[model samples]
Target chain A: MEKIKIEICVGTTCFVMGASSIQALEFEIPEDLIGKIEVTESRCMEFCKDHKDGHHKGPFVKINGEVMADATYDKVLDKVRAIIKKKEEN
Target chain B: MKEELFIEIGSAYTNKAGQDICGDTIHFKKIEDEMRTITVLSDGLGSGVKANILANMTSHMALKFVESNMDLLRSSEVMMDALPICQIRKISYSTFTIVDSNINGKTKIIEMDNPPFVFIRNQKEQVIKNRTLTSPKWSERSLHISQITTLLDDRIIFFSDGITQAGIGTKKYPLGWRREGCKKFTLSLIKKHPNISAHDLANEIIEEAKRKEPNNISGDDMSCAVVYFRKPRKLLLLSGPPYDMNKDKEYAEMVSLYQGKTAICGGTTANIIERELCLDCEIDKTSFDKKIPCASIMEGVDLVTEGILTLTEVYRLLKHNIELKNDNAATRLTKLLINSDNIDFVIGTQINNAHQDPNLPVELEIRRNIIKKIVRILKENYLKEITIKYI
Candidate 1:
């Protein structure tokens, strides 16, 4: 199966909003999902600039082509597992 | 009419071995509005605090008088009469050399009781004629004055007696390294690195002078100052994202079209450039400092760093004139600012909400404030020409 791509935004807003913790996903990937996921860093995806109302939101991550906002370590990990499981079933 | 050359002045000094402060003083002022520069180097009669005060007073008075349009010869005379005499020695003594130059034209050098300034042109020492001026008030003293039109790549190097007299009473040189020795050494340096900066060249000469002393400790306060006429070095610094997202492409275009070295100081700013210019930004994981975030690499950008944090660190470094040691983002940025003669800043007005949190450290000041502080220091302290544009 083709690997799922993960691009984490390491831009200033995202990094300060806890993207650094999500970056650790590279080292802590579950054994089942290790080889199936390819992780990379985006200097910024500019997702934070597209805010709802007037509030700026960040710490974004993209699974394949889908972007997840306000991302955390567990949220990113669970998303990666779900993507990998779906790819297997398909 | 001759085109104006960027005049780069660099100076270095070492204290008498046991003293914490250098007694030799070097001061320079660039009158930007007038397109001129005045540099003064003074060495006091003795070593330590008293000498420091004497040298400091002489250089300050000399610089101020010249800046006010006083005649260079008259200024030297006034400075001489103003200094107090050392009672035991029965001499009011301090040596000074002043180099006053018009950026687009000729340079006038005045020397009194210090080693004659060394003039280098085309990688060779060029001889210039000097007229001796003596004031009847101090008939015992004479000033050597020279006026010459300087070309690109010409360098004027002057130093205190300590530099010329290093290693006195030693077997290597019973008579010490005189003006001839200093001149010969400077010529050798220019031959080796024809493009060496005024700062590095002056530093190298001081280091060599120190080595001539016993145990590599200078016996007296030593100093060397160099003035080089050359082309200006340019740098562009981009930080923050544009307030209007639509302007991102224009901002990125500015980076692409700039002719000199470029640095991006914020992540979102880098992202805008990466996207609009179709360039890749890579994280540089090899070096890290606990205080500063790690730097990133990009196709055309010379440096990439986290915005507020790295800029705050840079402001502190420039404000205090701190010496950089680590290979982190802040030091790299500081070094770039120091080496460049002209700096242009493009700052985005976008507000980062994450930085507005009161819980954040106090050092994380607003981006505009930090850049303003950096600009003031670069202009006033480092004598750099700077321009800023807000997007």
Candidate 2:
């Protein structure tokens, strides 16, 4: 199976907002998804500013290049689960 | 949460004339004791020396008043009273942009009759809450001031009228590069070079304004400044050799464990790092950058320089009274220091017999004293994060 890449922002803002806990996410991964997922820590995604089209989101996690703003442990987990299920079905 | 360590400032300016005079004045002061940083950019009523003095005084007064914790509106009112106004124009002699940022990341920006400052976040425009303050005096001027807690990667970009007036009469755009154009251009630049230092970003904006004109001459003095916030950048500097010969691996191990950039000073120290880390230290003597000894390269180390000469030069540069830019090992080290939010000095206490030899042409201050002085200048003078460790 192809690996699923997740980039978590640990820059000052995100870290303060609790992205620091994202690093510990890897240790808690379920057995089924252990090797199938790859988690990386980025110092800063540098996206604290609002976009020209919309507002900026914080505590972001990028899964396969898609940004999930205001990330949470359960929210991100559900996102990964859904994506994995879709990939399996295909 | 602990306060963010320090803020980095970058400024660039182009005068209305190719000559020595510029009507715009920009000044920045960091007060470590008070835990506040004040920056002011003032544009005088008109161009030339007369305007220069007015703008200079305005910036100076603004910093003094704001740093003392005066209410900004009250302080600005007093400031307008102090400066002479142009009676015909019915405006104060200077229009200003003032930024007051505290250690806690709370920032207040006050602007009077200039282009609206651009504050960006997450690759989009931040909608700042601006309140209006009208001058009570006969002067009919109005100001916009906003207060917001800044986040990492948040940028405050302000510029003089030269940018607002660029390409006004040119066939390209009779309206010139207005605030909207400026914002769009900045957003594009920020998108392309997200990690650019404030200095480079400011210069890019000023240059873009110059390009808008076919004849390439700005109608007024143009200046731009950027304030960027980020997580503290940590640098570990290893110099000299450990007092205990046995701790050579320990020093190398510390560098190996450091997450930030690493700088190795002295040939012997470089050899120590090379030996412990099992990496090759190669000296590139090809460059004719004659100002100092040629720098070296080693795996896992960001910068490598000869001991005394380079350290002495870096100390002098850190103690440098004037603000200027240069390309050398010392300057490179300074750039790294300026860019970093904090620096850790890992000192080796060994005293070299050769450096003590009177026959040598160089003057060497005790390495500890040099490091201490560098730390003082960084903390007290530049208000940067710095600490020292002796081995």
TM-score (0 to 1) for chain A, all models? 0.86, 0.88
- Model 2, residue B233: displacement in angstroms? 2.6
Q: Give a tens-digit lDDT track for model 1, residues A6-87.
A: 9887766677677777777666787777688888777666666557544356678888978888788889878878877776
Give the clashing pairs for model 1.
none
Candidate 2 similarity to native, TM-score: 0.72
Model 2 off-target regions past 4 Å?
A1-90, B1-6, B33-35, B84-92, B103-105, B286-288, B315-328, B356-359, B376-383
Candidate 2 chain B worst ten-residue window by lDDT: B284-293
Where does candidate 2 clash, by residue pair?
A47-B122, A48-B121, A48-B122, A49-B121, A49-B122, A50-B121, A50-B124, A51-B123, A51-B124
Candidate whose DockQ is highest: 1
Q: In candidate 1, which residue ranges exceed 4 Å CA deviation?
A: A1-90, B1-4
TM-score of each: 0.86, 0.72
Candidate 2 lDDT over residue span A2-43, tens digit each: 888987765334544556566566567877778888887553
Worst 10 residues of 1 chain B by lDDT: B355-364
What is the C-alpha DockQ of each candidate?
A: 0.31, 0.01
